[model samples]
Target: MKQKIESKIQVKWKACNHGLKPQACQHWLKIYFADKKVDELEKAISKAARDPAKYGIDQPALERRFKWTRTTMTQVVEYTLQAVVGTA
Candidate 1:
């Protein structure tokens, strides 16, 4: 079930013009849930942290590579959080 939701997010992300790779989406989800203060999406966050090659980012280089604005990034995070928590 978790894998199914992850795949759904990947497909939705690809369908949109986010101009980011699947890894980037995974990274965003990780950062948002890393210190969420709630138990929501714990499994997903743990999985992301366990695989840096898949979800980790170079902090210094992200500014140059990722084009998303803070507002847009927040929106994605909120959307993902809602999807995960609301569905569960």
Candidate 2:
């Protein structure tokens, strides 16, 4: 006998800030720190918050709007994982 395993993941973000939600910011950070852990994610967001231009955030004010705390990042990751697993 043989067995097969497969998985698929899909994510949807609400239409807010022209799709620039915190989750979206996380994704943007992920593009740069693909193999990094949550700590790195927190660091990246923090850096972006301070210097939005470096992260390609054109709107200077919006940089401070994202919830860049470690707790928020952890929650976002957990929520995303739950959503993916729920879909599977």
Badly placed stretches (over 4 Å) of model 1 are: 1-68
- The global Cα lDDT (0 to 1) of model 2 is 0.47
Worst 10 residues of 1 by lDDT: 61-70
lDDT of 2 by residue, 1-88 (tens): 0011111121232222355467655653453243246557667666776777777775544444444444555565565565445534
RMSD (Cα, Å) of candidate 2?
13.5
Q: How badly does each model clash, as a count of residue pairs?
A: 0, 0
True lDDT of residue 42, candidate 1: 41
RMSD of 1: 13.6
Query: What are the TM-scores, per candidate, against the unseen true structure?
Result: 0.25, 0.29
Per-model C-alpha RMSD: 13.6, 13.5
